[model samples]
Target chain A: MFQKTLTLVLVGVLFMGIATLTYGTFYDKGFAASVTGMMGLGDDEHGEDGDDD
Target chain B: MTKLRLPKAFELLLVWHGLLVGSYTIAYLTAEGAPVLHQFAGYSVLGLLAVRLTAALIAGVRPPWALPLPKASMWKNFGRKLAAGHFSALLGRTPFAPLSGLVILGTLVLVTLSGLAADWWEWEDLHEGLAESSLAVVLIHIAIVSFAPLLKRLNASRADAAATALPRNA
Candidate 1:
């Protein structure tokens, strides 16, 4: 049961990481910005406040 | 060693569950700081929920894909076991699992819907409140799922200890 739970958690983290990376790439924000921006800590470089529209 | 294989339906369910966990975690983590990521995650959650509901409808509300509604009979059986001091009976599936799942599902729906409404209306506060409160439900769900396995392991270890101790006492 523990192993199953752990596997599920790892799979979730993998999906999340990939999705974040994809979002960054799609928006041309690069990896670091995409991550930090997603966390709301990145500085705006495209005149966007990084706020949810 | 044999390869660990799961049924197609089970695999799909695992993937769905994994995605839901990922999306929800991302949504919750980005809620206060990252608006873009938060929105992305929130929309992902909304999409996932839609899929789950649709699947439940199509599957005719069967186990492993159905809405986790705890039946009255389940509660009654669980209560009877507890009343009889049958702790081991609670080591496996229990009524609380479905109950927690039902609560989490309902709470998530409210949170997601309110978030969607907040995009145009003044439902931001309501959404935030529901999201915050939903964390508790999520945590409780986790606890309920984990509790059974944990207790089973504990009981096994205690039994092993007793078995070993019998030789020393003898």
Candidate 2:
């Protein structure tokens, strides 16, 4: 019982973290730019893998 | 300790990644901008969904669990009733909720397909429309996924306790 409850809490917290990260990264246009801007390319640049030279 | 573990693990994972985390990603992606990024998320969402449905289908066809549902194993069942509450919302509320949920979920599938077309064909509204509606659909998906296990656990434990607590004479 304890184990399950603990897992439940942990999972909840883990999901909350993922949610925060997701929301923090992409909730708003400017927010996405400022955050993901620094987090680097998130499949947006397509093939801009710096091999364009 | 048995063949059941694989399918059980898949069910737990389906709830976690396919539903919970997946929905969060979908919601944020749909609500935001960047065609490329949204497409990327949309692709991932489709992939995650495929993994889940495929897993469930395969598991159902075969008796992966000693029990009826592989997800009901007591060993792996651990979670707060809060999640149970969320999962049982539709079933407990009304018979119609499942039907409605199915309709909306179908729309979500369409949203994914439409978004895919929009990505390549550059159809203006399909992209934006699907993207906009996906947030809510994803939310519902995550919620149901998150709570299903909790509900299963709750029912299991309740049955166990009820069985044990029966009077010695009765």
Candidate 3:
């Protein structure tokens, strides 16, 4: 019984890992943009520093 | 002593997956800057895991070194044995194998999830933390595998001691 439960858990984790990796790899550009934005690494055009002339 | 042998196919798959994934991770850490290659490795690992999980679910057609599934008793008695300092016996038991498998899978999931989030959502902190954790888990897994034979010997010695003591008492 416990073995069955453990198997289920293993499958669940594997599925989640696969899904996450697929998403990150296939959509690299968007992910990179969002991550950089979140880190406040956006360029001048996207930056919110409010020093526009 | 029953020789410890994992299914040949399963073992090969695991070794291949480990090499691919490990290299990619090392590249990432060392600032190799080849994002495409890293992504490709991630996809390959995802494919390999899918195949492995599918084979596990199927009946009567598992690979030669079938997946090591621990018995129910191991989880039940884990705490008691752990508290009693029976480390060698615990490690040597067939039932205890699943816990290590669980740790490996759980940490892999964390690493993948955090890596994705860091890349797409800028959660660099989460990614870095999980990356370190994944490395630690992998190292421990390797250490346990390497020490299995020594642990089995220790377990045998303990049993011998018990048998000798019983004769003296009689």
Candidate 4:
């Protein structure tokens, strides 16, 4: 049960990490912001390129 | 073999996101490319993040479970090791885990600050400079995120190997 819980948590991180990692390539134009909802790389400020209007 | 089944298809989606977006970001500033490519790719990446966050938020309402890790100390111990790697080990036991959590939290905070500063910083100087620095912080954060699962996988495999290596009676 514990392992399962941990695995779920890890999965969560993995997906988020994936989101953040992908956004790194193209985050400012609109794709990163629109498609990813601004998933910033660890310390990224993915605001300008995201959904503002 | 225990035959662990993971969400391979979903995981693949993540891998694609990480690779394409990550490559674009690294290549842009370093290689000098057309600005149009940056916007399209960048926003797509952000949209991916939004989707993931929505999933995580939705998952939060599910029932919780416990692990049989022999003792509570094990979870704490794992957290500590993680903290040590992030350089915030002074917080006491379960160093890396808590530190990692804090860093993730800190990343969230910095994101808010930098995002606002990107357009609305009142100070006359250092706006761009501060924004640039934030990019470094994000890069470092992503690196750490990459290290985490790999680190755990290595540890898991090592433990499995050690268990299997014990001498058996003839």
Candidate 5:
């Protein structure tokens, strides 16, 4: 059961990481903002591109 | 012959990906003026990494990739393993085992994330830091992989010698 759970979690992380990367390549600003938010740096004044208006 | 040998297909993929990453690293280190090409190479490396990771994960039983994922209870036993020096044992288990793989995968993820953000936000700090970390990890990874074959041969020879030194049962 633990093995299954670990596998499931890793699989999810792998897929999610790939998906975010692919999406980020095309929509740079949104991807940057989302990743920054995920990193808890969304409140930083330096976060995100200036184009994020 | 229990020595490690990646499948021909996987080997080909590894070689191709290595070349791409090598080219990108070269550009990253020397051609700071060519941001366009550098960025292109970074993205290409990211794409290949994604493909390789996905393939490794999806391919089941036959010719197992031998990815040693951390047990779900790893945190509970982390201190014990550390105290017992099991970390080294874990790393030496296989050519592409979990600990090494986790570093490679995690570094690539960081590089990709920081690279994208660097390009988008015009901030090079995080990207540069992660790129340097990736370079160090990748170099160590290469050294280990290149030594694997020799290590296997040495072990095999030692085993053969030990067997020959034993008295014949028959």
Candidate 6:
């Protein structure tokens, strides 16, 4: 059970990382901004391209 | 040599549960500063919820796809066992599991719908509120699942100790 839980956690982290990268690339945001934004700690501007809103 | 295979419904349930967990985690984590990722994860959650609800409708109240509404009889039985001093009952599946699941599902549906409406209307506050409150439901669910196994191990160790003590007493 521990192993399975660890595996799932790792997979979830990988998924989140890939999602952050993809969002960063598609929106032209840097990787650091993407990570910080996803973590809700970034001060970056949003909805500039009229897409997020 | 025969290979073991899980039932199709069970396998699908596992997959759906994993995806829902992943999507909800992403959506919740991204809700503050990451609009694009938040919307993406939130929509994934909405889509997954739709599929789950549809499957429940088609499959009826069966295992793996059943609605998480705990029946009154189940609650009554669980209460009776607890009253009878069956601490071991805590080690097994309890009605709270389904109840928590139902709560989580309801909260997620409301959150997603409010979020969808927020896209065009002034419902962002409502969406955020629902999303924030849903975290409690998720945490409760996690607690229930995590503690059950721990309780089972504790019960097993106690039983082993009791058995050993009985021999010494004899």
Q: Which structure is stronger by DockQ: 1 or 6? A: 1
Candidate 4 at residue B118, lDDT? 41
Instruction: Please name the candidate that would achieve the greatest lDDT relative to the true structure.
Output: 1
lDDT by residue (B33-113, candidate 1, tens digit) is 566677788888899899988988888857678787888988888899989998776787998988898888889999999
Candidate 4 structure, TM-score to reference: 0.36
lDDT of each: 0.81, 0.50, 0.53, 0.44, 0.56, 0.80
Candidate 4 C-alpha error for residue B131, in Å: 4.5
Candidate 5 reaches a DockQ of 0.03
Per-residue CA lDDT of candidate 1, range A1-53, in tens? 46665588779867886796588657645777667765656664334656566
Each model's DockQ score:
0.35, 0.08, 0.04, 0.06, 0.03, 0.33
> Which whole-number lDDT from 0 to 100 does residue B69 have in model 6?
86
List candidate 6 stretches off by more than 4 Å: A1-13, A27-30, A44-53, B1-7, B157-170
Worst 10 residues of 5 chain B by lDDT: B26-35
Q: Looking at candidate 4, what is the lDDT of residue B165?
A: 80
Across B109-157, the per-residue lDDT of candidate 6 in tens digits comes to: 9999999999999898899899989999999988987788787788799
Tell me the TM-score of each prediction against the true structure.
0.85, 0.44, 0.47, 0.36, 0.48, 0.81
Worst 10 residues of 6 chain B by lDDT: B6-15
The residue pairs found clashing in candidate 2 are: none
Top DockQ prediction, candidate number? 1
Q: Kindly indicate the candidate among 2 and 6 with the higher TM-score.
A: 6
Tell me the lDDT of model 2 at B76.
Answer: 28
DockQ of 2: 0.08
- Native-contact recovery for every candidate? 0.37, 0.01, 0.00, 0.00, 0.00, 0.29
Estimate the TM-score for candidate 2.
Answer: 0.44
Positional deviation of residue B43's Cα in model 5 after best superposition, in angstroms: 1.3
Instruction: State how far residue A14 of model 6 sits from its true place (Å).
Output: 3.7
TM-score of chain B of each: 0.89, 0.47, 0.56, 0.41, 0.59, 0.87
Error of 6 at B4 (Å): 10
Tens-place lDDT per residue, model 2, B12-52, is 65344434344435434434434434554556556655665
Candidate 2 lDDT for residue A32: 53
Summarize candidate 3's per-residue lDDT along B60-96 as a digit string, tens digits.
3455334456546776576667778866454555444
